[model samples]
Target: MDRRTLLTLGLGGGVAVLALGAGVAVRQVMESRRAARVTGTKLGAPFRLTDHNGQPITEAAFQGRPSLLFFGFTHCPEICPTTVYDMETWLSEMDVAPEALGAYFVTIDPERDTSEFLKSYLEPQSHRILGITGEPEAVWDMAKSWRVYFQKRPLDGGDYTMDHYASIFVLNARGEVVDLIPYGTAADEAKAKIAAVL
Candidate 1:
């Protein structure tokens, strides 16, 4: 072949090799992620925090029982309370025994959501749903570990509000993330997801 033809062929072969390598890399990553999902590997890091009753708790609390976790602040005007109520309804409809499941409302606003405050805020809604809060840094660290997002939004007055993830994390008995029931999911759909972990 001429020099021009030889050069073109060499460039084309190089591109083909690069494309093959890229495809292999992508497949490996996809397979790894699929294996993680299938094996139900632990998705959140360990943490130490206090329950609503002022008792110390750890990630170990999630082990040995299916659990549901959601991140929100009590001061939230609408979504937080509504989500908690939805959680109660789903569990009740599913006939999930209180002892058979672990449901936690973890505070994204630790500055205002103390253990006592969480207790009072949660008591009337559902006895089965527990509250979790801790030092601001610790709470934020735990939230980060769980891949939760939150930010403070300034209001006209001196007060402020929080914007945060509103989905419920469904975890299996091994603390593996089974699914996330997004905000506004239908009650029946939520029940089905939670039932899977149970």
Candidate 2:
């Protein structure tokens, strides 16, 4: 082959290689971002609480499976139940085995959400949807450890309202926090994210 022809071919091959490398890099970056959006953080501090059955539960209960956790009270009129319902629907649609995942509802209003109340309230939900509550001090400590915010507001009828942060925590099989989905996360998106982890 002529020298000029050989040189041209070499340059063209180099350019193609570079283009492929660039494409791969872009794809990797996109995938990372998607994973981050689906799973917020990868570390979860330890926590201990009482299950709806009044049994002592801890992060240990979540070992060997991914846990979808949310912090709210049974009395929450709108956001709490709606988010739980969405998670339930999304989890039901997932192809994961039943033993591969769990759902936990941690109550911020430990004062009002007794074991009996939680059991009655969550009866209609899936059995996988476990409810947890504990002493107010311990519950608050756990909330802080999870970086969740909550407060109590007084009402005029000699009652009170509890306002708590609303975010879904996704934990991996080893009981480590992997990601967080906000309250408005779409059902399809949640399912896709969970499927990715599974």
Candidate 3:
């Protein structure tokens, strides 16, 4: 190739690389902003739900104490049960007073997970963790306010299952989200995050 043509091609390639690099940087900044927005979101939206004990509860209940909030249903074949077990283990290991850390399991499948059913489902897992359920609209509204994503999936025999966000939310006394411990996080790491909020 001619010298001028080679020079032109080299310059074009360099410009392309720089443009690509700039695009990547812009994308990274946008992602960072999105992450900030998610973390800055206020939690504890208004809702009236029944606890496992059939007692009325609201967003007010989350105030005045640090909490570990998890969203799942009793019928989950794996993640839900495993997370419950992990939560129970973490709380036991932390040795925190029961009243000190309010651990809750909010059901996204309220259609089938009633207050009574939740009581039975959670009893074996850990009394330390309470279950929350209510009318479908109210339950889903609460979840939506917290940015939880849950959708129903049809199964065989006309049954249905839930696809949901499976993470433990650690919140401070005022119910502001401190950190999210994703499913299958290391026990020590999860405990550290929970303890930080507490």
Q: Which candidate is the best by TM-score?
A: 1
lDDT of each: 0.78, 0.70, 0.77
Q: List the residue pairs that clash in candidate 2.
A: 39-179, 40-179, 40-180
Top of the candidates by lDDT: 1
Task: For candidate 1, report its TM-score.
Answer: 0.82
TM-score of 3: 0.80
What is the C-alpha lDDT profile of model 1 across 97-186, one tens digit per residue? 999999999998999999999999998999999999999999999987876656676776698877666677788888877676766799
Residues 58-110, candidate 3: write the lDDT tens digits. Answer: 99878899888888899877778888899999989989888998999999999
Give the poorly placed runs of model 2, Cα more than 4 Å off: 1-44
Model 2 lDDT per residue over 167-191, tens place: 6777788765666676667777878
Which ranges of candidate 3 are over 4 A from the true structure?
A: 1-41
TM-score to native of every candidate shown:
0.82, 0.75, 0.80
Candidate 2 or 1, higher lDDT: 1
